[model samples]
Target: MASKKNININLKVWRQKNAKAAGSMESYKLDNVSTDSSFLEMMDQLNEQLVAEKKEPIAFDHDCREGICGMCSMYINGRAHGPDTGITTCQLHMRMFNDGDTIFVEPWRSKAFPVIKDLVVDRSAFDRIQQAGGFVSVNTSGNTIDANTIPVPKADADKAFEAAACIGCGACVATCKNGSAMLFVGAKVSQYALLPQGKVEATERVLNMVRQMDEEGFGNCTNTGACEIECPKGISLENIARMNREYLKASLIK
Candidate 1:
């Protein structure tokens, strides 16, 4: 095996003391960063350097760095999750940049997701949307039938699983020029709508979720398709179409 080379790079990081404070990009130079290091690990190194100098370290969100938590939200060099495709910020590697490259890191930007601090945005809007109607209300007090007993078409099941892959990372919203959350909401809606267990309250679920999405102040989807392209999970645009259909059916039936 060959030894991976290390590189030096410059970082431009956004810093804000609080939600009410104005923010600006701050520059820092790093030396001998390993190309094998993950982006979050590089960030840790930066923080360590700052602390050694008695300066307040950059604050960024990260947990379950394996990419499942979606807490590591970052806009790197003008792209969500750095220059990688189908990966989150924690999964981005330092090898993507060269020695002399300058990397810019910022938080997810949108009216719905206000900045809580440097590189940390409040994504609770998604939680509120989910709470609105993201589940199937089934009575579990009695004897439950085996999940396999109910027959489901293989196509619908597969699509539902794909939609369920969304991690709620907010990259779709950040990447979209309009900062629309249609892709995220669509995935949440489709995951339920495609399942037989979800059919009972399907109409109400769609209506409530869509209504909550609008109330959160997210921009409307203009169909530019940036959300689908930048999604870390590669959640298909088809889910958006499915959500639209579900919403229309719900609206008419109600």
Candidate 2:
């Protein structure tokens, strides 16, 4: 087999001092990028070069570069989490691009996810939405029963497990024309609504979460399906429909 080739590429990265600071795209040429190197690794190389030149390095959020954290978010080549699908930015490989490719990297653009510095954005809005109601209350003082004793249908349990896989990466919002977050919220709601333990809090959970989502300044889902297409976890659009049903049921309950 032939050896992998290293490529040279250009990058147009967005730089910002802070949320209140004005920002613009700054260009840089990166050389000898190994095809085997992960996108974040190439970013590390760029930072090393910047440091050697006595300039401030780019700042991007990343943890668990293996892709589970879903923290390494970037709008690359006008796509959420880069030019790839079903993976976060950290999981993107340099091999996907050619030697002369000019990659455009920017932070997740949403009113809720304001840019913090360089490629980093403030995604705490998701945390606040989850905090409003992403859990169930269970008795613990000698009254709690073992969850294993409960019988959950395999179909519902599997869907719930799949819905639970959401990592809150904000890719859906970045890829959305309206900067909507219904996909994420819907996944969170579906994970709970599918389980018997979660049924008790279903009405309150959907109401609180949807309410907090709107309060975060995220736009409404217009059903363009962009969120489902760009979601790194492959979260389905059905969750959004399920969320809509849950929300409707909750509204009537109040």
Candidate 3:
């Protein structure tokens, strides 16, 4: 028999004209924000306010508001995907904040992930890294094998499936002080290296992926484990270790 009161909040958002242009924090006040609204929904409200006032609306990347796409690259209040664990920005609810809280919203901060505009960054670096080696060059074109029929150990299959859960959100890099992408790269490498179909390309896969990761300006793993902490999917440090082993084994190949 009670109605929930909507809260008012302030947003200190990063604004950039473009990747080449200068940027700054612009402030906005929002009132009566529904706690039930997801973070992206609140952002939509803010954009609507800006548009209604004839100002440039804040631009943020988001798709599958369901949190699967990992496109909501909002670094909120110094935490990737907001101050939450195991969730993306699109999954964050307004109820997480207090009535008068001032939320600092910024794009994914990394040399590789340059800012495109307010709360949006050029994460194409991830795409390039994935393209470098995130695949198996199997000749299953006409003779596709039933994956279930393939003989695979349950343990290896489990690891590969877990590794495949990575959604490539770049939170691992954003939260990292060194801006490292070890977790993301590790997951990619592990996903394939654990499977039979990908073993043939293992040596080349790890080498190419690691080389491209460095070329993309991603830093080396700091060993601080921040990536695992902020990762929305909880991709483990084991994958990073596995990748390191793969890289070492690849490098040792004369």
Report the lDDT of model 2 for residue 96.
88
Please write out the lDDT profile of model 1 over residues 52-93, one tens digit for every residue.
999999989999999898899999999999997999998999
Error of 1 at 86 (Å): 0.4
User: Model 2 Cα displacement at 81 (Å)?
Assistant: 0.6
| Residue-by-residue lDDT tens digits, candidate 2, 1-254 | 11448988999999999999999999999999898999999999999999999999999999999989989999999999888789998899998888888999999999999999999999999999999999888777997889879899999999998899999999999999999999999999999999999999999999999999999999988999988878888999999999999999999978
RMSD of each: 1.9, 1.7, 2.0
Q: Give the clash count for each candidate.
A: 0, 0, 0
Pairs of residues clashing in candidate 1? none
Which pairs of residues clash in candidate 3, taking residues 3 or more apart in a chain or in different chains? none
- By lDDT rank, best first, the candidates go 2, 1, 3
In model 3, which range of ten residues has the least summed lDDT?
A: 1-10
What TM-score, over all chains together, does every model reach?
A: 0.97, 0.97, 0.96
